[model samples]
Target: MFFSKLSYTLGLCCLAAGTILQNGQVRTTNYPDIKIDVASYRFRTYDANATEISYKGRWDSKKVSWWSAPGLVFGFTGDTVAITFGDLTTDTTLVGYRIGGMDWSFTNVSAGATHLFVSSATPGVHETWPFNPLPFELRVTNWAYGVQIAQVHVAEGESLVRIPPHQRTIEFIGDSLSAGMYTSFEGLSSFAYGVGAGLGDTEYYVTAYPGICVSDQNCWGNPRGQAHQWFYTSDTSWRASTIWGDAPEPWDFERQETTPDIVVINLGTNDNNSANNVSTATYVDAYTKLIQGIHGKYPKAQVIVMQLWMGFYASGNSYAQNQGYEQELKDIVAYFNSDEYLSAPLVWDGATNTTTKLDAPSEPFVSYFSTRGIMQHNDIGPAWHPTDVGAIKVASHLSQFIKLTFGWELVATGPEIFHETLYWNDEQNY
Candidate 1:
């Protein structure tokens, strides 16, 4: 009878890898109760002795799978599942395992050191292994040292493959153009790494900060201020005391686990360069006290305040009191639409013209004082910021105004536009 139905499908793949290996541990029936923590990570230092980390996996796997040892070099480009951990000899830390039901962990990691342990599943199906291939067995430990994991993949599943409790979450505060700053200087396939590879396969949480500025100061010194940076940055270790102190108030957003249905605030170009500028009554009293401290930490999110595309006082004539700093940023969105306390309606002419025009200076310097003007142009990058095709046309116009005001579904396939010249040079050493 077809060899007894191929020996009952190889005895149900050896009783599903022996009920996902127990007693020694290695669970996951695809996601039964949700619990995967590796909660922190952040690494840098690329070649003083190699430290080029990259690990992404959210889905799409026609093949290629490995779990533990052999060092690193797994691959997959489309659904992104890249890993590159070359021989370091000195700084080394590794731990990765999977079974398939639920319960994973790995938090707030930065880089140079990290450790998360739990093990057991060793038996086969690493594409039917043989030459010394145990099913699974991770007991790993090293713990902490400079963690770096910037967004991992797979979060929850199986309620007919879940993922729709108002589409996970997302709260990206800004400044330094939502703190992507130079958007990783044209790399990781820019377009802010293709919107972090289309939200690193869902379940968002970016809490940005990159030269932060709304009016909390440090206009561009790079110390990250703007009333104390947040969205999430308590210690993903890149240290300097978590990127230059002060930013962890607003009652720590009542310790999140999920409380953001989109809150993207893109801070005024460093309060249009502070000093004698920030007025319109002090930029509407520090932008209504930072939108009342983000509505007292996300009272049903959905904030969205962005406008200023080509960085540093975004050219209106490159300042000289550029129309009173563009009418104090339109009176901070006209005081958030005359105090509706915003849930919507605050896109004050979302500027981004990317201006250009300068060429005419042959003779005009006879002991200066006045009488010689006409040299205006602006479009900066680097320390001045925004270039990776101007941060992919400001993330393709904020992903087409977040898919036309929240129909949300940015690029799984075009029409919301964001080619930005196919990532202009998608980062690698820029």
Candidate 2:
């Protein structure tokens, strides 16, 4: 039930004003507790690939998941912050933390919690006052854990600050509702991280998985060496391989440092699940070779092909009504737009057989993103996935369809990225 989430970081935070007891931890009545003069505090560890820790997604810096580094922003001048981590599969992990980024606080190290704290000053109060440094920014929520970070204490005269890196980036590849799973808190309420925190200076990367399959074989949830969780990098059967290293490989992406100006791709509902009946020419040749391997590793990415509100081999499937597979994802984005970057004209309305449209200069970008009923079933949950208010209304309509297909503007801070036009038609929804 760890749903504690609150964000207001449009640019690092430290407005200090903590106080959240009742077992909610986070109480720095304007800073003081460094054990209130435990010799002016001293801890300072910081090795989890420490470049002053800022690691973002597709995580494999030796195992860190939320389908890949879901979150781990760090910086401190202390009042409190400690997180050592090692083990916790407590019914599929759950540990969220925050401060300065307001509210959020959760933990389920399941009795063996290796260590975690984000108290701005009142965890076990004994207040003797005086010790204010405050510059906090603590964050460590990598839900659906694969925990392995091994240090980050912060107290010893504090100093770690390095939170800089966000100039647009989004790279979610999906399954399990774009890996935000039954959202009460999975992949940090996925929608690939709330469309990378509502596109505010972006920064996202996921590579989802659950019952993944874009057709690498007759699927059934990791059925048989399924290499369709978007050509792997993780998911050695949900991380194993003798300590994350005996299998699963093929995802180098030329050692990323940002190369995803948009990738989306929610993939075919487990190859049209009916026990993976996969065959419409093998799910259109493995979803057209997974968009020719994301156009040979992101050649100006902007892929996007979502359409699949929910489906896990029939335990309450959602839609594919008239399964023509949304016209085979508009013929695989018109064979990856083979006609000089498909300069608009993909209108096909066929009487609401579940919409399709790519009308724009749309160059180099293969499109289509219709999760059909666009969420409604109380915004889903439990197996039918999507629930964190349905991954925040599917990340606020895919962040207003990538801020109207790349004219981009909204830099987080709620609502108003305009350009709306996803009006469905099976009796309602817009």
The lDDT of model 1 is: 0.34
TM-score, candidate 2, is 0.33
Residue-pair clashes per candidate: 46, 2
Error of 1 at 332 (Å): 5.5
Candidate 1 structure, TM-score to reference: 0.26
Minimum summed lDDT over a 10-residue window in model 1 is located at: 363-372
For residues 1-430, write the lDDT of model 2, one tens digit per residue: 1111122121012111112221233433332212222234467777777776766665565645436336667556656676656553322244555443244445444322334365555442223233123223322233234655666677667677766667778887766566654443455566776777667767777766655676666344354322354555565343444445545554566775567888887766666666566677877766766665565456567788877654223335553322347887887777777765355324321112122334444455687877665666655543455556667777888778778877777766632221112245796655
TM-score of each: 0.26, 0.33
Per-residue error (Å), model 2, residue 300: 7.9
Clashing pairs in 2: 200-411, 200-412
Given candidate 2, what's the lDDT at residue 343?
50
Each candidate: RMSD: 23.4, 20.5
